[model samples]
Target: MDAQEKIAQILQRLETGTCTPQELQWLQDWYDNQPALPMHTFRDEAHKQQLKTGMLQHIHAQLEPPVHVPVVRMRYGWQIAAAVLAGVAGICGWWFLNNWQPRHKMILVQVGTGQQKELLLPDSSRVWLNAGATMEYPQEFSDVRTVKLDGEAFFDIKQDEHHPFEVHTGQINVQVLGTSFDVKAYATLDETQVTVKTGMVKVLHEQKGLDVLSANDQLTFSRSAQQYMKSKVSNQQISEWAGGMISLSQAGFAELALTLENQYGVRIRFNPAEMKQDEYTLRCSKQLTITEVLDLISSIHPVQYDIKDKDITIHRKN
Candidate 1:
């Protein structure tokens, strides 16, 4: 087999726990033989940031207790395995995206933290997701091109008048014939929002029935609003997060706190949950300083926060 194909097989073997100790030794030796590549050097640029976000997770997996150790140790080999896996994963991602012809009807798309992923559905529709997002679909489009999403996703749907595309987000459902839209349905966010960039969409709240939204229309449902509020959205306001942007409308302090906690990999808690009702807007993307985001929110609402290591606490301005 070719070098790339061989590496791919080895990586799969490793993931499936089928590689023998001797095989692992050879794999490790392969990696150790090559000069170490700085881990940070692999950070994907701009559109490829999603790959960088999950680097830590992959690294952790490397340290996982091995199923077995080889009787003969290859000097300076473990690093080689890591390097090989990295190369294979990069190749696999590219191959998967460019040459996607899987026999399965449904394909699953998963992205790691600080990671963003984009997929072209079986129906020729496109979907982009923010950090920590996942999407699952049939390998092939049977009767419908429906997908289940957790976290957030921006879709550029292909025009299919016969079989419309539908996205199920636990509590709500968004359906479109041929429309471009974005959906943020994280439970942490009191409200779920779907902004239509093009065409039209039908937003159905199992609790509230059908809400139709046209192009440039944004439908926001919050814990307080309880009903769909249709509003005009600035061009490019939604789907910007896929480009490393953070866009939140009518966002509360509680939500902001959670985002900060997620971004920095820290924890920030508020004394009274109600205090999070203070609404604000934030933009922290593209070389923007994180401190600016924190300071901006603090200016609007009088709040006190205590930083205990990576954990933070916020209390009312008392």
Candidate 2:
């Protein structure tokens, strides 16, 4: 059989899942080798639109279940090859316009201290950016969907099995097909944390797979030690900040101070170093003012605080 007939048979087998791994690899190699059509070559807007529609229709048909059709003989191998390559070029051109073009320009979302924001990505995925967080994403996703995050955010990714979603945070990467998760990776903090709420995610550090997390799973990577810890957490408790709630469980004074600072946009100072070691468990709504929250903290612990403008000083009570 000629190359065109062989390729058509292989494609049919691929659709039916009967193609061998080697055959699949061969097809991929062939596609990768095909020359891409230059965008400048399109003569007019109408011509470009026509080609896009045809390519999209062809792609959609391939994705659907196979239908029986009689094979038509072609006289010249070169003619059949040219026709196939032209279709491939049209597909490439469509993708270039829809995906690659938007990536040249990125959109940035930055949440200042004590300010939180919500974002809707090009793929309709939702993101809740926490205080002092920054996220950068393309105007549209290409073959791979990726976003860069600094600080913290909660993501509810739209499902797309063909294109996986990835979040890049400093040294670590969180990857998923479709899932809800929270990531905290402050540059000043020694640890980076990822908490999964639904579906599954793969955590990678320096291109190496560190762990796979399912619903309620949490992964903490220590920057100083270059080690990671994985554990289970209450999924409902994850990303409580998104709901305007601050929840802590047996958290130390240092951590509490950090949380308060981020939530209230204040600088906290401890009078004594020993106070940093103090631990407490608490939950409070963001609706309460910083003073009220501190009062509650004082009631629970033997401490007093002085607030002056945006600065707070905490001291142990005698």
Candidate 3:
């Protein structure tokens, strides 16, 4: 048989605990004669030993118990058997590097201005990201489903009571199990809001639990003041942005400007001194062009707007 075929047969025998002593010796000799694998560098000696022990232990657990081998030789036989398994696992050189390596790949998704995105996570959870938002998640979730968000997202998580889902933002961490919720935690905005539409959510700050919210419940945390307020919200307002609509109530100039920037993929520049502290309540369709929305605003309030190719300037009418 060819060298690879012979090696495969030997490994198969070894895995099944049917390798004779002579076959075991021959396999050991083959491994010794083969070229060494490209060694993975470790941070420290202790870390290296720790990983080695873990791999060997895992491989050993999968192997069938040795048969017809003397008790005195069991220890040495098992060690050699594990080494053979490791060597076989390194067949393509790539498998060993990827599987035996101690790193988990993380993926980052960024939504550009005026754009929205939808993702189905490994756990079958669905997320809808708003414009000007970014999210980070591991390629595969572990014991706990965790994701980081820098803007706003609506999450409909699948039920897994054993593995609670977590959303980490700037000011707060939200934990849930099979729930639908919306989180608004833009870095530009001073306040972080967590609103639940269904199921229960637990919000925490700095590892301390802030409040538990149920359906139609909202928790607002002010970053600047380091304060928390829990209030009731209408279910329709929970994730209205995801449905091609923008709604605001008692919103300030900055909030309005930010919403416009994210929705239109434009930059807005306005002088705070020239603008009044007028709170605007707007419910408009996201399909409206930047100029159209600005015109609508002007009709309601006496304000002049200048639009120049993805940039807008607003000032109070003199």
Better of 2 and 3 by lDDT: 3
In angstroms, the error of model 1 at 306 is 2.8
Segments of candidate 3 deviating more than 4 angstroms: 1-103, 273-276
lDDT of every predicted structure (CA atoms): 0.68, 0.78, 0.80
Of 1 and 2, the candidate ahead on lDDT is 2
lDDT winner among the candidates?
A: 3
Q: Count the backbone clashes (under 3 Å) in each candidate.
A: 9, 0, 0
Residue 29, candidate 3: alpha-carbon lDDT: 72
Candidates 1 and 3 compared by TM-score, better number? 3
Q: Which pairs of residues have clashing backbones in candidate 1?
A: 31-80, 32-80, 104-139, 105-138, 105-139, 105-140, 106-137, 106-138, 106-139
Worst 10 residues of 1 by lDDT: 95-104
Per-model RMSD to reference: 15.7, 12.2, 12.3
Estimate the TM-score of every prediction: 0.61, 0.67, 0.69
Show model 1 residue runs off by greater than 4 Å: 1-106, 207-209, 223-226, 272-274
Q: Put down candidate 3 lDDT per residue, 18-117, tens digits, no spaces.
A: 5555565666677678666556545466755665565455445444345654433334666766665555444423333443232257889999988889
